[model samples]
Structure formats: structure tokens, C-alpha cells
Target: MLEGDERTGAGPKGALFCPSELRIARGERPSMIGTLDLLGRPAILIDQNGFVAAVNDNASKLFDDDLSVKGRRLFAADAQSRLRLDRLITQVRFLSGKPGRSTLQTVVTRSQRRPIVIDAIVQDWESAGDPLLPDMGALLILTDLNEIPRVSQSSVMEIFGLTPAQARLASLLVEGKSLEEIAFYMNISSGTARNHLKAVFLRTGTRRQAELVSLLSRLL
Candidate 1:
């Protein structure tokens, strides 16, 4: 059994796929939320009863603004965003014991800012207190688009052998900058921005923006 987890057995695995780098070794106390914080992301953990169990340090910045935790429950300031958040929670709360998709994704939009991307992953609390997930029923990983990603453009260029312009474009996309906005910021015409984007796609082997964002986020 995981250290200090004698009360609960290991569940199969949470829906959130933890990379090898994020995993703790045997005999170590695993901190899933802590791992996410190391990468400069926010983690909101909920229990089987649909109550907010815990949140990491990075998550504190989100409170009283884009999101709020009231009565140990998480909520979005926007009505539509709150509805989507509630739906995701319900699905994750009941995801197990039923054959369904292993992962789900949704966007939590802010009133006057870029939307927050959410990935809701379910864990079996009955068998959970394992090292990986502890007592958490579900893990909500949030990527706020309004904030620029911590990834470095030089690293992207070196990893993918992309041109400086292409790497900048990738960084811009992750920053929630639209194509038009990116073109304006870079002082390039829209067509040129499209060309740079296509080049980045070929270099990174990512055909879509979301795919690129997911891949780049892992780099952090």
C-alpha cells in the first residue's frame, strides 16, 4: 500500500493521465495537486460528495474572480460557465461504475477575458486514497487562457527545429491570441501569420491548435 494510505486501496487509475515525470516513486507520499503546481497550473480537487476537498497554491489566484469556492463547492462567475462546470463535475462524480469515455474537456469562459480550459478526471474514492490520487474523488486541471503559458519559445524552437517566427506563433496561440490578433501583434499580414502557423504545424506534427496547446503545456 502507498505510505499513509492504509485506509483505501488503489483504484485502477484516474482519468487524468499522469506522465512518468509527474509520478512519485514507491515509498514516497504522492502529491498530485502539488505536481501540477510545479508546472504552474491550478488544481481543484473534489470529493465523492461533490465538495471541494482542496486546492493548490496556484489555485488561490483564481478565487474571488474567475472562480469562487462557496460552501466547499466550486463555481464560475458566469452563469453559462457555472452550468458547464457543474455538468463536468456531475459526469466525473459518476464516471466510474459505468463504461464511458475515459476523459472529457470543456472551456470555462470568463466575463471579459479568455476562457479557462478544464480537464475533469475521475477517481474512485472508495479505492482511492492511493499515492497518486489520495482521497480525491476527481481532479480538475485548469489552464487559464488569460495568463501566458510559462513555456519558453526558445525551447519550442529547439525541440521542433521551428523558425523563430513559428515558435513565437505557437506561444501566441497558447496565450489565447486569435489569429488576427497575433498578426497585428507581430506586425504581419494575416496571410503571413497563416503561413507561419502552417509551418509550426508541420514542425510540431500538430494539425490543430488544441493539439499543439496540449503538447506544449506538457513541456512545462
Candidate 2:
């Protein structure tokens, strides 16, 4: 139920405001800000420069603060948060005016002392024709201490046309072992190992081991 709009302002690039869907937001009309607060997921609105404009109730509770975060540089809250946000921002920026989505995992400090892990999704916002808030930028949704979903071996095999053995080989490849190590562990010959790996690459349309690893790892 979260919503926001980008406005031409003296603030960050993708700054968002509550839309009409959330009634609890402090505005003359109903706004989505209230719904954002109710979501267990940590939601944040950022400006173009990647500064924190608004954070939902969950975020406030998690950080144990009700103080306004508006206009604060995203990274300013914590060094680690800053670094993570910077990377997300960089990815968003790289899309060059196209809306994009990306995910990041980072460690953050709770109550300015306790460390916690956060998984976040960064998405670009498209302006729906309003001139006042025209340059809408991005929305960041975060989950605390959760594992990112990964594709199972079966699913990966089905999607990439890998044989059962090749799929198992791909899984091992994602674990960072060398081909020889993988062969030894899987009780297969080196030649068979190379053959399985080659088939994995062809089925996955990858040309390099690192690329294959990255692609397969993200499936999960």
C-alpha cells in the first residue's frame, strides 16, 4: 500500500510523498503514507541524490526513532548503510533514465549500536503525468534478516535445459569450488566434469565460469 510521487525540489533525486491511498499520512487528503507504515517490510522514499526523505513506521520502529529523517543523506545514518545505498543508487543510475530494479544486502546498526542485516529492493519510479512532482525517482523496500529467495536445482535445470548431473554441477559451481574440486567431490572424472560444465554453459547461454556462477547464484 505504499505510494509516493517525485517533485521538482531542492531535495534528493527520487523523493516521494504519500499518494491518496494512505489516509493516516499528515496531509489534507488521504495518502498512502499510512499504508506504508503498516507494511512489515521497511519502506523508504529517497530523493534523486539518494537522501532519506521518508521512512515507514516499521523503519522507525526498527531504528527505534520517531525523529524526522527527511533531507538526511541516506548514508549519513550509518557508514555501512551509506555504502550499501550508494551501490544501489549507482545501479539505478546506470539504467540511464529507464526504470529498473535491483536488490542489495547490507549490515546496519539498530539504535545506533546493535548490528543487523537488511535485504532491500530498489526500484525506479515513473512519473504518471503530474508536473509538480515530475521527476519521481526510486522506491526502496527492505526486509530484515531474511534470506533472498533462490531457485532450486530442479527449477534451474528446467529453465536452463541442464541435465540432472549438469544441474548438480552448476550448483557446485555456485559454491565456488574449482572444476577439479567439484569433480572430485561429485565422484566424476575430470573429462566428465568438463563435459557437464560445457553443457551447463551452453544451456545457460553463458561464455565464462564467473558469469555462469553469477547467473546461477541469482536464480536462488
Candidate 3:
């Protein structure tokens, strides 16, 4: 949540675009820091100046020996990934609006066995409509190979507004299952499975199975 003093620092010109929720002083505490820790996901918040504002416990452990992130520059990671993070941060800072939100998929070598694939989402703290609080910065939500990603049937249905049958079909499609195989597993006829796929496509606004797969992959 960016608000208060942070917004004033941007001066009047920048304040014009300040989100409505940030216009008034509510003295809200930074709640996301605690929430991230509870979720046990590695996430960090950095100011536009590229300094780490806060880090969750998981992030501290993930980069335990490699880099000390809090209050330091994000470049402490590695040469290649540092460059990628630098660009991501710059992109968010310059864009500074809902349209400025973006995601970058990059790999970081934190071990000798294999590199960790990181999906970094850089977005402004605009949901609460405040960018003026002290140390209010954009978020860098990182998910790596070590994390177990489970997308439940209900989650897909709620996210895409799909019915239970449609959600099951879409999740199967994301797993690269064939239409016939899906029908067999669900104990339905191939035609019924195809019909569910059609409904999934319409609900997700995707014409092809590949497009539907891509959409669900991102959401999950």
C-alpha cells in the first residue's frame, strides 16, 4: 500500500494520478508483509530507487547465503538475474499505473544441481489506492521450482467463472490430456467431454485448447 508521505514526495504533478484511496491519511499498517510470511512464499518489496524495502521470511531463507536483500540493492542475487530484475523494477516505476503491471519469467542459479525458474510479478501497490506511505514500493512476487503449485478445481472455476464440469475439463486440458482421455477419466462420453471443453472456451474467451491451457497456466 503506497500512500501518505510517499505520495507527497512525488509532488503535485505526480499526485494528480494518485489513487483515491491514497488521497486521505488512514495510517494503515503494512499488512502484506505479515500475510506473505504466513503464506510462506518468497516475496520482496522494493522502492523505485531499487532498494529492498521489506522481505518475507521465506525470501530471507531462499537467499540466505547468496544475498542479504533487506535494505540492500536487489543486484545481490546474480549477474544475469540481477539485470533482469533491474529491468523489471524500472518498468514498473516508469509505467506507474494499472497498465504498468507486468510479469517476467526468468531463471536464477542458486545451486549447482539446477537453476530455479522464477516467475516474477511486478506491480504497483494500487489495490488499496495508496502509494504515499513510508517505504511504499512495488512488489516482486517470486515463485520458483521448489514451490509446489496446486490449482484446485474450485479455484479454476471461481477464477474463470466456469461450472464444475467445465473446470474439470479445463484443468485436464492444462495437464495436456487428450479429449478422449479426459472422457475416459471422467467416465463420460467423448461428446460430453467436447461439450464441456466448448463451454470452458466460451467462458474463458479462448477459441482453442492451447489458448485455454495458456490462460489456466498463468492463473495457477
Model 1 gets an lDDT of: 0.69
lDDT of candidate 3 over 1-220, digit per residue (tens): 3332453434322332222322223443245755876766677666655556655556645553334332355543567766766676676566434445566565665644345555555555565455443344466666556554445789898888988888888878777789999999999999999889888888889999888787788766
In candidate 1, what are the lDDT values of residues 55-172, reduced to their tens digit?
A: 6667656655567665567767788888887887777677743433356677877877888888877756446445544445677788777776666889999999988888888888
| Candidate with better lDDT, 2 vs 3 | 3
Winner of 2 and 3 under TM-score: 3
Output the number of the lDDT-best candidate: 1
Once all C-alphas are superposed, what RMSD does model 1 give against the true structure? 10.2
Best by TM-score: 1
TM-score of each: 0.57, 0.40, 0.47
* lDDT of every model, 2 decimals: 0.69, 0.57, 0.61
- What's the candidate order when arranged by decreasing lDDT? 1, 3, 2
Per-residue alpha-carbon lDDT of candidate 2 for residues 15-74, written as tens digits (9 for 90 to 100): 322332222244421133346555345666555555554566665444322122333544
Question: In candidate 1, which residue ranges exceed 4 Å CA deviation?
Answer: 1-30, 96-101, 125-134, 157-220
